[model samples]
Each structure stands twice: as C-alpha cells, then as structure tokens.
Target: MTHPHRTSDPGVRARFLLAATAWTVLVAAVLVAVPLTFAGRLPDPVASHWGPSGRPDRSMPAAALTLFALVWLVVAGTGLVGLARARGEIRRATRAWFAAGLGWIGGFLIGIQAVTIAANLDRDGWSRAASLSWQVAVVVVGAFVLGALGRLAGRLGPDDAPPERERPGPLIDLDPGRRPVWVSTATAPWAVGLGVVASAAALSFAAAALWGLAPAGWSTALPLALAGVVGLAVSSVSVRIAPEGLTMAFGPLRWPSRTVRLDRIERAWVEWRSPVQVGGWGIRGLPGRATIMIRGGECLVVRYTSGGQLAVSVDDAETGAALLNALAARKTA
Candidate 1:
C-alpha cells in the first residue's frame, strides 16, 4: 500500500548513513594504506637532491589528497539527498559536511608539518614555519576552491518535486501532470562553449610551450589564455521547457539566449560525460567517464547522453526541478 505522509517512494532509509560511512571508511583505509606503502610518512620532506629517492615527493601527497576529496564528495551527496528527503536535517547535515571539509584541510596541513619535522630533525623555527606556509598555500587554496563548488551545489539544492506541479488541471489541456520546462541561460553559447574550448586550447598551448614552441607574439598563446579566462568567467547556459521547444540561456551569467525546439532536444539529465553514458555525476562506465566535475548535483544533460555531453551547467536549479517534473508528468500521462 502507498504511504500517507510520503506520496512517493523516499528511496532507501540508510542512504545518508550509507553515503557517509562509505566515504569515512574509504578515507580511513587510505590513510592506513599510505604510510604502509610510502614507508615514509606523507608530505615527505622537500628534498634538495636529484636522486629519485631523495627528490621532493609530490605524487604521494597528491594521491593521498583523494581522501579529502572523496570525503567532500560523499558528504556533499549525502547532504543533498538528505535535504531533498527532509528539510529538518539541512542545517545539521550541512554543518557536518562543512566541518568535514575543514577537518580534512587541517589534517592535510598537519601532515605537511609532520613531513617537515620528519625530514628535518632540528630545522630552525623560521625554516619550518616558512615551509609550512607553502604547504598551506596548496592545501588551503584547494580547500577554498572545493568550498566554492560546494556552495554552488547548495545553491542548486533540490526541493520536493511538487506533487501537484506534475498534474496540471485539464484547462492547460496539455498533459495534466506534465510540469517543469527546461529553461535556458542568458549568456551566449559562444561564451560558454568558448570556455570549454579555451580550457582545451590552454592545455594544448601548455603542451606547445613544453615543446619550446611558445610564440613570441600575442598569437603565441595570449588569445587562448584570454579565451579560457573569459570562458570560465562567462558562466554556463541551459534550455528548459518552452513553447518553441526549450529555452536556453547562455549562462547563469546574463547574456543573449536561444530557444531550441523540443524536437531538437535529444535527451536530458545527469550522466557520466564523455563517450556519453547517462548516469550519475563522476560516474564511469563501458565507454569511459565524465571529465567535468558536476558540483551541482543532478546535472541535466540535454540532448542524447552520448558523444561528449554538452557542458550546459545551469543555475536557479528550481528550473531543472520544474523541467524534470514536467518531463515526468509528460511521461506518466
């Protein structure tokens, strides 16, 4: 029989716990694994020698950084799922995740200090302090970046898809339950597309630079770098339901817009991007996996979830919920 308070399935009961436990356990296991394999503790001393063994090690700590990253992702997912299920725990769960982030940063900083101490038995105070400061730059800067991503995710936080929103009255005559229309951004497609192109172009330029092909003029790489900076700053665009087909905004950033017909929209929803396989964010599959970091949970991959998903990052995600609800209604009807 259907439940009373909850009209729809709330999904698994221990979802939150499961997500949290899985992450925490994974980190603990890794922390244990690191020291065992490295034989030398993390943040190994910044070496001054050229010998492979004596070189300042970066790979280990970078690998270990995954622990902090995994924890953040798990917590973020947990927080989002829980918040969707019930607002009662939003604040509490958010705190736990935030603290987890800070804790990870703190632990990383400590690890760096430990490395310093282990490497130098009696380094002068200034030396140790100076070294530690550099470590902070790596750890803390990354922490803030992740924090920004988290904030964006929170901004797109989901709400209970209004039960009635799905079911419109007969007057609309369109599908009754059909709700939510994918919306678009105002930014130009070029701006957003250019950002992606810019990222690739910048990487290519870097490769060129490494090959000693750095140009002496603006064409050398300035345009590519400039484009990338603009692209990153340009924001992303999206298409929601519309009379024509779907309305697309250039980005969360205000810009020109385009409305493509629903006929053109091949498909939608989150999926592992690249060789496109519709699945969860960061999900991997037969083809490959998503390269983009979908901090905003539940990305709407408009068009077929195949062949390099369009990176139409969006905002005011209530728009997405509306779009999904519309699609669900249409599907059910």
Candidate 2:
C-alpha cells in the first residue's frame, strides 16, 4: 500500500516552478532598469566597496557592476529553485523558508545596487561618492522585512497532498515475553579528517598570536576552533533502538541527542539514499522529512503518526528497520 502523503503531485511542482521563475524575472528587471534609468547621473566608475572608516575604497565600472549583480541574482535564484524541484513534493513550511530566503537575497542585492547608485549620483568621481553606512543599514533592514512578507505570501496557497509510497516491511517474529534491542554507529571519516585539519590550523593560529607573530590571530583562531568542534561532533553518531523507540546521540559525549518514542512511530522501512538526494551531508531538514546522514547508503526511515518522517544512515539498516517495525506493531497491538 502507498501513503498518500508521500505521493508526488504535478500541479504542486508546476506552481513552484512558475512562482520561482516569476520572482527571478521580476528581480532581474529591477536590477537592470534602476541603473539604466539613472545612467546619466551616475559616474563612469561607481563606488562598490567601503573601508572600515566608511570611505569608498574600491570602484567598478557602472555597467560591469550592474551585470555582475544580475548574474549573481540569477545564479542564486536558479539554485534555490533547482533544490526545491529536486525535492519533489515538499512541505509548506520548507517552501516558505526557501521563498523567504530567495526574496531576502534578491531584495538585498537590488537594495545595495540602488543605494550605490544614490551614493554616486552627480558625483565628480568615485572618490567623491557619499558615505552609505546608514543607507546600507536601511537596505538590510528593508530586505529582512520584505523576506518576512514573502514568507507569508508563499504560505497563502493550499498545501500539496502528501506523496504516495509503499509501506514498511513484514513484521518480525518475536516471543511475547522477549525484548529485542538494536544498536549501531555511523561515521564519516572525511568529516573527521576535515575536523582534524581545522583543529591543527586553529592551534597554529593560536601559537602565532601567543608569539606576537600575528597580533590579530586570535580573531581567526576562535572561529576555526568552533568549526573544528562542530565538524567532530557531526562526524559520528550512535543509534539505539529498543522497546522504548529510537535514540540517536551525536559524538562521544552524546549530550546533543534525539529520541522518537515508540508511540509516535507509525511505520519503519529501509531505503538506499545518497547525500545529493537530500541535500549535502550532516543533519538535513527538508519539506516533510528530516535526515541525519553520515556516509549514506542504506537508511532506516521512520514515519511518525503526525505525517512527518526521519531517516538516518547506519549499518544493518534492514535489521534495525525490521526490529523497529515489529516493536511498533507490538505497541499498537
């Protein structure tokens, strides 16, 4: 049998693509028109960068800057649209977030371009351009406000019906008095290697700061150290399944963990998945699904009674899924 929520709908996909295309075209038009409208007033070279003191430090040709901004907006819009389309039938919340993100980026670029033009209006040269600190701040704030509005607009339409997919595997035979538990660990050696490299770099920077070789090295070292810690944390996770349900702990400390109670689980199944299928590695939150991916291959997928699903990549996913399904069945029976 197939679940209604998991079935793909063509209408939903078409609407998303159409909306995305319209937004992209509209933003592209604004970016192009604003500059050409004020071409006579703007200097040949416009101020594109400002130093810490708010003085224009870098300048680019007016035409080139406009072209660059348009290119950037198109690329970003296309990427967001492609990702959404690739996910097929997605949840309304996810679509809203994606729309808001695209709106914010497009608005931000357009606002910055407009501000730059205003700053350079009737200027003798790039050096005489007005300081844009306050104007840039206004643009950022306005972009965020527009993004929130876009999110609301995106949610106005009806939500797509859940897609259709086959149900979980056959139940396992279990003794009435017996309790079975499954445990496994998933790890990514590449992530661990990256973490080690980052840690090494952080230590080098810290030593340089201590020796007064690079006085501001601490600024760089702190962020690197934090990234290293995060990489290590996500490099491995321990998964446990028992009569109580499923529990997943990240890293050796297991401080940050997630648990799904047996009562909430409606079904369990094993599916082969890759990183690209659910965005890149790490913890991925999609439309109606959440994935904890390490080295993706066979993933144990759990569907909650509330219609949401979670998938985790680990060894012996078939056994883990079968055992979990049996436990869930027992609970319901």
Candidate 3:
C-alpha cells in the first residue's frame, strides 16, 4: 500500500527474497523426492516422451531421467540466482515474474512426475502417462502464483529521487514565446517489417501444429501466443510530446501508453546508441529507463525526476528532445 516514489522498503525486499527461496526450495525438494521415493518402483526405462494425445510414446533409462532432472535443477537454480543478483533491469515487477515462471515450470514438472508415478503404480512394461489435464492445471496454478507474488513485490523503490538543484535550461536556441505547441511523430518501418515476418512464422508454425504436421499442445501454442503479442507491440507505434509529457503507445489504444510526466522530467537530449549500449533492440532495457531501439540510430533521451532515463530512436531526435526540454523547462520554471 505504501508505494515509495523511488525508495524501496525492507518489507518488500524481504518478501521478494522469501518468494525466491520458496521457489528454489520447492523445486529442489521435488527433484530429490521424486526419484528417491519411486526409484525402485518405477520401470527401469520409464516412459518419457509424450505425444499430441498427451500419452507416453517413448522411454528413457532411469539414469538418463536422473540426468534430465539434474539439468532442470541447474538451469532453474541458475536463472533464479541471476535474476536476484542482477539490478536495474530485473526490478521488483520483473523479478516477481521470473520467480513465478520458475514456480510454474517447477510445479509443472513435479505434476508430471506425480502423474507418472500414479500411472505406473501397477504397470509392467511401459507406464501409461496421464492426460494433459495436469499440464493445464499446472499452468493455471502458475498464473495464480504469479499474480499473487507480483502484487506482493510492490512498486519500484522510492530511493531514486530527483536532485534539488534545477538543471540548466534547454539548448534549443529558440525563443519560448515564438514556439507554438510543437509536435513530432513517426512510424518505425523496421519494427513493422519485423512484426510482419514474425507473424508469418507464427502462422506457419500454428498451421503445422493444428494440421498434425507437428505436435499440437502447450509447447506449440505458447510461442504462437507470444508472437501475436510481439506483433501488436511492434506493428504500430506513435510518439507524442505534449504539456502532460512525452507519450508512446501502440496504435490508438493509449490507456497503457508509456509516459514521462512533465514534472518528473529533469532534462532532455539527443544521443546515438546500439545494442551494445542498451542491451538489445525492440523495446529493450530496464523498467524505469528503457531503450526503444527500433532501427537504432539517433535517440531522444529524457532524464526524469527519479534519476531514471529512457531513450527512443526516431528521425529528427534532436528536434524532439529540444521540444521536450523546452516544455519541461517552462513547467519547472
């Protein structure tokens, strides 16, 4: 409830750590408990492959199964640790998502193991694996856990406050009185092209899965769903600078638009960068400060009150940055 503007409180930090620990412990416990409890009972080479019908199609030696479990443990553990240790980009919200994802994956795998054990209780040669219901249940449970933990993680810490001293005025050289309400907007052709390509690929994959050319199930659907989202995010982008702040949104759906309030902006400038500087391209970087590297050339950088910065690549970035700075200065003055 107490949302600090820039500082993080102890309670949130504690909860975050606790959630991360819970995820790791649960996974480790399941990984160890599954084999120890059912090692002698399970078939020497257990059914390991699942078909589109969600039935076991192939088998793996018990030793191979153990190796697989260890690999999963290592991968899941390393990711959680990295997310916890990394700063800036993996903030509270993102961290919670990572935790939830681990939780979901761990839960799903455990569920599969449980189902396998139950199915093999009286089996002879091959174990008849359970239906896909368990998988669906795992997904639902994971989603619920994610929402709950995300809410518990709280907002960005209030520690990153703005400086007391005001910054120097804009270097635009234009008289504030002479300039009318300035505006600049442009579409990212590269992003649009990328979106189209991704959409085409997604469609192809989905068709293959649906028509039985490939396995149809959660694995096949997840990537298709993500492709749709990426397509929407990149296909249509428009940037606007006004008295309220600088706004960026997809198409006309502006409710979720990313905006830096006029009061929060300290200064603005123009810069050029590549993936080497801002991590990667296409809506990349951290939460408070992100780099919208569409085509990657000139970018308008806005330094805000919370000591955070955001960069958006666009044509005539100098003009956009100058206008933003002028507007911010007038408001601050």
What does candidate 1's lDDT look like per residue over 1-333, in tens digits? 655554223333234345444544554555555444544333333332123334333323324433444554565455435344432223333434443553454355435434543444343321232223354366566656655553443333333332332222112235555443444442335555777887787778777777777754336466888877656554454455653455654434534655545444434454212111122222233322222222333344444223333334344444553454355345445
Task: Assess every candidate by TM-score.
Answer: 0.32, 0.66, 0.47
**Tens-digit lDDT track of model 2 for 129-186:** 9886788789999899879977886665556564376465646877888778899988
Q: Assess the local accuracy of residue 322 in candidate 1 as a C-alpha lDDT between 0 and 100.
A: 48
Candidate 2 residues lying further than 4 Å off, grouped into runs, are 1-9, 25-87, 121-127, 162-170, 174-197, 242-245, 251-318, 328-333
lDDT of model 1 at position 251: 34
Candidate closer to the true structure by lDDT (higher is better), 1 or 2: 2
Which ten contiguous residues of candidate 3 have the minimum total lDDT? 154-163
Can you give the lDDT of residue 277 in candidate 2?
A: 53
lDDT per residue for candidate 3 within 1-333, as digits (tens), equals: 665454545555556666667766766777667776787777767776667787778887755544536766786776655444443333454544555556566665665566556655445656554444466576567656755654454343433343465444345644656643444544556556656676677777777788888775447557766775665575445678877888876632432577767898888877666543454456787787788765445777788889887888767777777778778767767
User: Pick by TM-score: which candidate is best?
Assistant: 2
* RMSD (CA, Å), each prediction: 12.9, 5.8, 9.2
- Evaluated at residue 95, the lDDT of candidate 1 is 35
